[model samples]
Target: MSEIWFRTGEATVFASEGQATDAMPEVVIGSVKGPVGTAFASMLGQTVGHTRMFILRDCNQQVRPAAIMTSKATITNSAYVGLLGGVVQAALADAIVDAVANGVIPKDIVNDIAMIVTVWLDPRTAKDENLDQKELYKNNYEAMTTALTRAMNQEPTIDELIANRKTIRHYSLEGLDIE
Candidate 1:
């Protein structure tokens, strides 16, 4: 039974010592934001849909969570997201009739997708259960204001937000909301 393992380069692994145990890199898992999923889905829809439109076969799938985690860290590209969101919105606008007619997406699936996308865009709408009136109103107001602002102002891009954002003397250092 060997207690240590040597490497060609200067790196060595010792089984008896705890160095090898702690040598493994720490992997922090995170979620993916922005329109990566939408893009992936669109591509999948085009390619996979052509081959297996609605087959019930279980295909082996491998997802890279690390890739998703890294992408989520820097997914502040609102312009890219807006592009994908526009596509999703456009598809959703007529998905019901068109998908059903074309047999691309099922009606039930379309409805579910609409609900999911609606939830992703405005989470408040997805809450079916009742809550405190004040909190409910707050969430509703936030969601409505966000939607209205985006619609009226053309959904400011992340670059625009970064460029336009300015800090007040007192608020800037304190990280407080100026407006």
Candidate 2:
């Protein structure tokens, strides 16, 4: 086997001693750069929901036919958790794609997503019984808020928080929040 040398902005040349042989063609991998919108649209268009079924099935398998036998409510709750996880994953993926398309930096995507989930899980803005079903909403609210504050390096102002709350409520009641 002969070694190949690469030079930047220069054509690859074979050394006298290192002649190219009839081997498999070299596979060169290159970075792709393009319009963020196109890339995001392509990613979001792919089949991303197939894991939901697997997750639900795993949950069912774990909770069913135990020696002691699981209650119907226990099984139901397990299914709900799996379903909810899938939903949240899908929602976050969509949000991230949109954010990237809109020029959000890759480094800041996590914080942006944290802020988004915080708003979605805020009890003050939660609509219907989603937030009323136990303290899940409250717990998520506290955790996400803390994460957002830490990421921001400072606590968000009251007006800013209220605006986010209102925006989320409007988004739930009306279609997308217009702001």
Give the top-scoring candidate (TM-score).
2
Q: Could you list the CA RMSD of all candidates, in the order they appear?
A: 22.5, 25.2
CA lDDT of every candidate: 0.26, 0.26
- Local accuracy of candidate 2 as per-residue lDDT tens digits, 1-179: 11111101101112122221101111111112223223323333314322121111133432110101011112223344432344322333332333334443233332212111211221121232333232332333233223322333333456777878844553245765465
Clashing pairs for predicted structure model 1, backbone only? none
Q: Against the hidden reference, what TM-scores do the models get? A: 0.21, 0.23
Q: Alpha-carbon error at 53 in model 2, in Å?
A: 16
Q: For model 2, what is the alpha-carbon lDDT of residue 80?
A: 44
Predicted candidate 1 versus true structure: per-residue lDDT over 21-127, tens digit per residue? 11111111111232433432443333211221111112232111111111111223454243223322232223223324545333333222211122122222123
Q: Which stretches of candidate 1 lie over 4 Å from their true place?
A: 1-131, 157-163, 168-179
* C-alpha lDDT of residue 148 in model 1: 26
Give stretches of model 2 more than 4 Å off: 1-76, 106-179
